[model samples]
Target chain A: MPEIMVFAATGRTTEQKRGLARDLTDAMVKNFGVPAESVTVQIIESPRDSKAKGGILFCDR
Target chain B: MPEIMVFAATGRTTEQKRGLARDLTDAMVKNFGVPAESVTVQIIESPRDSKAKGGILFCDR
Candidate 1:
């Protein structure tokens, strides 16, 4: 199974997440010949405080 | 920067997650020569209900 994981700051609508899942599945099927049923998309919502960029926490930026 | 994402069932202990983050970062540093500081490990916890296996939702398993 192809487990696709995406991470971003929290707060996407359910529709966006669903669309992403579907898109990822389609891409896997297209490129890797993986069946749609075997592809999994997991979206990780990271709190700003827990993520940093360029020496600054996302929460502080 | 290497953005490594891992997808697994919810309920890993904090220690396990941290260890995974460090291990992933180390691997990236060793193989890709990316600085450990530039590596990001995002752990995605999928709810059993939202994830399916063999056309069946994990919640039922």
Candidate 2:
């Protein structure tokens, strides 16, 4: 099974997330020739405070 | 460099996430003997409705 995990800021609509999941699965299936069901996608949402970039926290931006 | 991503339901404190990141990085450093700074940890949160298992959505359960 091919597992893909994405991390983004919180607050996306369900439709958007599902669309992304399907799209991601499609990519893997078409490229790697894996079955759709064999692909697993997990979109993880992180708060601004939890993520930092270049020594600065996202929440501070 | 190694990247470890985790997906879970939302509502964890920043402290918890940071602790997890540190711990995960530590594990990679000890096991793989990679530099601590080379490990990337991203904690992603998903809504229950966004995840499905065996054709049954998490929100429906």
Candidate 3:
């Protein structure tokens, strides 16, 4: 089972999420030689306050 | 760099999210011998309708 997890900041539209899932599933299927139905793509989003980069919270950036 | 992504249904409180991030970071640091600062934990939550299992949407389950 090939599972793809994407971590990103919140704010994407439903359509964007759907497109990403589809694209990622297609990539896995083509590169990994796996069935599309067997691939799972999960998008994980965090609010700015909950995520940090370079020792600074994203909300503070 | 070791990044941890968690995908789950939405509903956790801020405190729970904070605890999970801390615990997961600690786990990576301990197990992988990586510095705590080197660990990144991101939680992605989806509504029940956005997630599915066994060919059925979670909202319907």
Q: How would you encode candidate 1's per-residue C-alpha lDDT over B1-61 as one tens digit per residue?
A: 7698677868789999888888888889999988789988887686654444433445554
Model 3, C-alpha of B36: deviation from truth (Å): 0.4
In candidate 3, what are the lDDT values of residues B2-55, reduced to their tens digit? 877677887877667666777777777789888877766666778899888998
The DockQ-derived docking category for candidate 2 is: incorrect
Model 2 residue A28 lDDT score = 85
B1-61 in candidate 2: lDDT tens per residue?
7899787766789999989998899999999999998999987676775664322335654
Residue-level lDDT tens digits of model 2 in A13-45: 877776777688788888999887777677666
Q: Give the lowest summed-lDDT range of ten residues in model 1 chain A.
A: A13-22
Badly placed stretches (over 4 Å) of model 2 are B1-45, B52-61
The TM-score obtained by model 1 is 0.55
Query: Tens digit of lDDT per residue, candidate 1, span A1-61?
Result: 8776676776666656665666777778899997878877666677789878898988899
lDDT score, residue B51, model 3?
A: 88
| TM-score list, all predictions | 0.55, 0.55, 0.57
List the candidate 3 regions with Cα displacement exceeding 4 Å: A1-6, A10-45, A49-61
Worst 10 residues of 3 chain B by lDDT: B13-22
